[model samples]
Target: MTVNDVKMILDACILCGEQYIGKEVHTACGADMMSDVLAFVKDQSVLLTGLCNPQVIRTAEMMDIVCIVFVRGKKPDEAMVALAEESGIVLLSTDHRMFTACGMLYEKGLHGGASD
Candidate 1:
């Protein structure tokens, strides 16, 4: 799916990276643990997470994720947004819980960061 598709799936806002909305996403990962994000995610353009902190952006940067979706209405601070913006990572927020958000996107064709 594309970043536009991800925005639609999560009903997200373009908190940053407005220029990257057309980018395509082949995979995704959902987690609050930065360690898990670093260890498990691979080639995922979008990150669904509730950890609205600087480390979240750092993890996305390290993993090369193009976008991050903050779930359950968790709003990230300006510092986190600045970090994401600097890293060229799009940021978004949604009210949906983690499970529901991941399920919706998965049902719509978003896959985990793994291949057969």
Candidate 2:
């Protein structure tokens, strides 16, 4: 699904990377574990997490993720937002919990990465 589609699906607010709203994301992974994200995610363009930190942006950078959805009303701090802006990653905030956000995206045809 496109980034705009994700925003619509999750009723999310754009935190940054407004220019990337039209980008397409084929896969999504929802997790708070950065290691799991780095190790298991492949070509996954979107990350859904409740963790709000600069490290989350770093993990997204490592995985080449283009979009990040902060679930459960979590908001990234200024540093995290600046980092994401610098890295050209789209940041979205949604009131839905991680599980609900993931399910919504999945129902809209966005799938998770392949399992090991």
Candidate 3:
């Protein structure tokens, strides 16, 4: 699904990189802790997180995640938004909690990361 589709599905507000709404993403993983994300995530295109810090963007960059969805309506601060924009990552904020947000994407065919 495209980032636009994700935003629509999650009813998210774009916090940055609006130009990248058409970006394609097939896999997603949700985690508020960056440590779990770094340790377990792989080949993932999107991150659904409640973490609202610069580290989230850094982790996305390290793992090549193209989009970040902030769950439970959490919005990152301005510096965090700047970091994401500079790194070419699209940021989205949604009111859905972690589990429900992740499930919504899964139900729409966006799945977990590939084990490869």
Candidate 4:
């Protein structure tokens, strides 16, 4: 799926990187633990996380995640957004909780690479 597909399915708002809405996303991972995300390596490009911090952006950068969805209506501060912008990561916000958000996207055909 693609970022546009996710936004359409979840009715998410692209808080940043509106230009990347059309980017293709091969895989997604839902996690708040930065270490968990770092420990695994796959073709994951979409990160669905509730963790709001500068380190989240850095983790995404290191993982080459193309987009981030802040679930449970969580909002990152301006600094996080700036870091994401600098790293070219698309940011989105949604009311769906973490599990539900991950399930919805999974139901729509997005997977966390090889892991179930």
Query: Which candidate, 2 or 3, has the higher TM-score?
Result: 2
Task: Report the lDDT tens digits of candidate 1 across residue range 1-116.
Answer: 88888889888777888888888888888898888888778764688998877888888888889889999888888888888888888888888999999999999988885562
Name the lDDT value of residue 113 in candidate 4. 74
For candidate 1, give the lDDT.
0.85
How many residue pairs collide in each prediction? Answer: 0, 0, 0, 0
The ten-residue window of minimal lDDT in model 2 covers 107-116
- How does model 2 fare in lDDT? 0.91
- For TM-score, the strongest prediction is 2
Model 2 clash pairs are none
* Candidate 4, residue 62: how far the Cα is off, in Å: 0.5
**Candidate 4 on 80-105: residue-level lDDT in tens?**
89888998899999999989999999
lDDT winner between candidates 3 and 4: 3
Model 2 CA deviation exceeding 4 Å by range: none
Candidate 1: stretches off by over 4 Å:
none
What are the lDDT figures for the candidates, one per model?
0.85, 0.91, 0.91, 0.87
Worst 10 residues of 1 by lDDT: 107-116
TM-score of each: 0.93, 0.95, 0.94, 0.95
